[model samples]
Target: MENVLSSLIPPHGGKLVYRVLQSAPGKSHLDSLAKIRLDQNKQMDLEQIAVGTYSPIEGFMGEEDFRSVINTMRLADGTVWPLPIVLDVSVETADQLAIGEVVGLSDEQDEVMALLHLEEKFCFDKEETVIKLYGTDSLDHPGVRMIYEMQPVLLGGQVDLIRGRKSETRAYELTPKQLRRLFDDRGWSSVLGFHTRNIPHKGHEFIQLKALEDENCDGLLVQPVVGKKKSGDFKPEYIIKSYEKMIENFYPREMVVLAAFSTFSRYAGPREALFTALCRKNFGCSHFIVGRDHTGVGNYYDPYASHRIFDQFPDLGLKIVKFDEIFYSKKLNQYVQGNSLFPEDENDTLRMISGTQARAMLLRGESPPVWFMRPEISSVVLDSVRSGIQVFEG
Candidate 1:
């Protein structure tokens, strides 16, 4: 019988999601959590769960299938705190719900799942396992009810609006080597990475420029996320247009390239930030910028945990550029670091323009403060927001 790790989830291109255990000691904040043991029986039972129960989201399994640890919940010392989570994952179509496609199982979760005794079949009301972070005793979310699974035997494979639109764009699908060559051509010895899900802000520009001017990075990779994000975020088209304008007007033409990252956003705060930096490395970037709450969601984590996590993992093979939140000061009429506020400008310190603020303002047909945005970016985003034109349309 296949274990959770080997259980085949045919939704995500047949890729089995697994965890990376045993980082060098003292490297992660997660080391203090309870350790998971690899047991053979649990592995065998996973096969049953896969065949009998796994379903795709919304009854659709795409050409690919997946089973991987969706969340990376660890503590400062590299401990695995398994949090029992209930997800009403929908396999949106029959194509995504293949016969053997497991919904929530992945090979990488074996040790942690076994450790937490999560192998039991659960009813909706059963109290699921709770795993705590290593350094702290606080348990993460609990009691997962595997409510929905797609039960389609087959699905139609056809081009949809998303695929069709993307095909029309001047998309640059690159391997690491190809991207490396582009960087190497520009004589840039190092590259600074910026992850985006919105239109570029002045603070973002300042950070990227600082990497070039101060850190002497060769180029900037304006990688944007093309995945599930919260509602009303800057559509990818807007981001692409903003970067294009930046490239055309401000940046050295060869110094920047826009790319797309096909990943979901896991607002895991610090750990997720570290994971993001590593992923940027995989794209051939030697440096990454960690901004305030980089990959953070709401009040879930410390403001500086992203940078702190990098400090814990020094050998991660990438350099991190830490920046405080950038805000616009009315007195100086420019962007300032989050930590330093102007003496005379107290009221507006809290008013620094952000994507969220800009979205609201634009939707209401208000122009953002000039200091927080470049003229072109502000105009384009506002236009898109008001006119209801998607910026990332292929």
Candidate 2:
């Protein structure tokens, strides 16, 4: 039998999707089709889909795929897709659109971004969608709130990006195909992917180090999600800069690389965790580290829910390295697992900071305790904030 968790990873759908249009459409072409303006988050989804970031899922999901994903965590074809990746449209827009018609997908500014080959349009049970996707329908949940605010109709189709974002040359802003090529060029067969949305704290460094060392991995990718994040989370630019500093000063030069994952956070807890890891697999990461509340928010998920969900997919085609929630133990003079020598009652000996707290500290021009955040990493955040840069999402 073959090693199902082999490091030689393949794209989720076996073949990577590349639907980028090589050139801009002609005037008549743009004028010929109906246009739908995509919000920023949806625009990011379009680009990712166009580049195989969500491989095997070439476009916004049809009703069949959406229902299958929401109810079973699988695509209609039984592919293990943890989240429903669908395009929502206003009921009026859906009414105007007809089946089999091609539509132009544009930004709010009306710049033509892509062409959606519309295959299906359907209404869904909003309450069921929220409950299934989030495990909650309470508006208190951020993901649930976003879902509740969405339009009632969904459009499903394949897309062709109009060669935009190609101007972006940063190595960190890479697509799945480009990322896989980078891993191959580095000769990394068993590279580990570490996901983050915050500036690198000592806890994060500790987790990555433990994962790298424990796994005996050939390489490590410090991939940070640089898309729309919660309000208090660090901005993408600073997150990238902090890691740039972390890798420069602390990590081995050749064994690590930093890349920005251009996908937004859904705060779907365990489901998003599984979704992110599979995305890493498409990016050629053979293994992924799931730590703490893995993509969770506001006490909505069990801390180790991400760890347990991996068991459901025996042939996940990737390996998940689960780590206990870690904190800086002053007694040990460094970061350690929660189940370490220090007991829970020893509050004075443990140091931990939430992202909201960290942001507030930066706003106050104060460096977090050196135990929780490195001076260098903290300096990057402080600089970004002090310079009037929008360092946090609002």
Top TM-score: which candidate number? 2
* RMSD list, candidates in order: 14.4, 3.2
Query: Model 1: per-residue lDDT, tens digit, 309-378?
Result: 7776655556788889876666566667877765556666454656677667666767766676777877
| Segments in model 2 whose C-alpha atoms lie over 4 Å from true places | 1-7, 165-171, 340-348, 353-356, 384-390
Which candidate tops lDDT?
2
How accurate locally, in lDDT, is each candidate? Answer: 0.50, 0.83
Question: Where is model 2 poorest over a 10-residue stretch in terms of lDDT?
Answer: 163-172
Candidate 2 lDDT tens digits, 217-263: 88899888877666767767788888888888989978998888887
The TM-score of predicted model 1 comes to 0.59
Worst 10 residues of 1 by lDDT: 156-165
